[model samples]
Target: MAQPMAELADLLTRLGTWTTLYIDGPDGSPAPERDARRTSIRDRMLRAGTPEPDVEVALELLTDDGPPAPSSQTILVRDGTVRSSWTSSTPGRGSGRRS
Candidate 1:
């Protein structure tokens, strides 16, 4: 998401839409490194000049330890309502580079 967020900043600079990030923790619970990763992403987005009001972040933590979610999704929410949500069937897509 390094250059991508920067690219997003460029695209959203002249627009009023926002970009929200959800850090879904491992096993639905917060990872030990969750803070670090969240900080990194937020900082990168800000450094890229993403407008403060145009950026949002949320961390979804689980109630108990369990396996990772079977799927990853992109969800759009506005005014506390889901506008859209889609899960990718492509394996290892959200986990990052495989090789």
Candidate 2:
């Protein structure tokens, strides 16, 4: 059986994908200004013939901000799991210049 955290991850993944489908404009078109990319693990999984539930579980584990740090090699263990890594910028630490 999977853990609660894993379950939450799966839900979030599905929600993320469904959210993307409801966005403005048709698929393959660029999102309008001020809009953000809403693609999710579910979208990728469907494209690669993977099960949505499995993809969700893997995304949950890979995104957990626990020790060891997240990385691309963090095997998702799903059929179409696309392993990726990202570095976010810290807020409030700008170049100290006026706009």
Candidate 3:
């Protein structure tokens, strides 16, 4: 737990504005549900002034092919590029913010 917190601190120390996204991927959900979520994410990112390139990259990371089991994803982007991202088996609600 300390190691993870240290890593997060390091990430926060980086210079430049950051866009962090937490998404609960639509694993067993319907196609429309997934599409709606994707659209919402895109809109939010754009509204928050995230670069188009970064938004596209983040969307790519959020993709799921209707897997039987659910999963969560976290995407970090800066200056129109994806800095880091990861997926986990735990379920999570979708959200995004810039700092």
Best by lDDT: 3
lDDT of candidate 1 over 3-34, digit per residue (tens): 35555455445544544544342444366565
Best by TM-score: 3
Stronger candidate by lDDT (1 vs 3): 3
Weakest 10 consecutive residues of candidate 2 by summed lDDT? 17-26
1-99 per-residue lDDT for model 3 (tens digits): 022666777888988788888766455667898888889989998998888888888787785743234566678888768777776665554454233
User: What ranking emerges by lDDT with the best candidate at the front?
Assistant: 3, 1, 2
Q: What lDDT score goes with residue 57 in model 2? A: 53
Per-prediction count of colliding residue pairs? 0, 0, 0
Better of 1 and 2 by lDDT: 1
Model 2 agreement with the true structure over 1-99: per-residue lDDT tens digits: 222556547645752232111111223334442123324545665697656665565544432232221112122343334333232222222355235
What shift in Å separates residue 2 of candidate 3 from its native position after superposition?
A: 15
Task: In model 3, state the lDDT of residue 7.
Answer: 78
| Over 4 Å off, model 1 | 1-31, 57-70, 75-99
On the 0 to 100 scale, the lDDT of residue 60 in model 1 is: 32
True-vs-predicted CA distance for residue 55, candidate 1, Å: 3.0
Count of clashes in candidate 3: 0
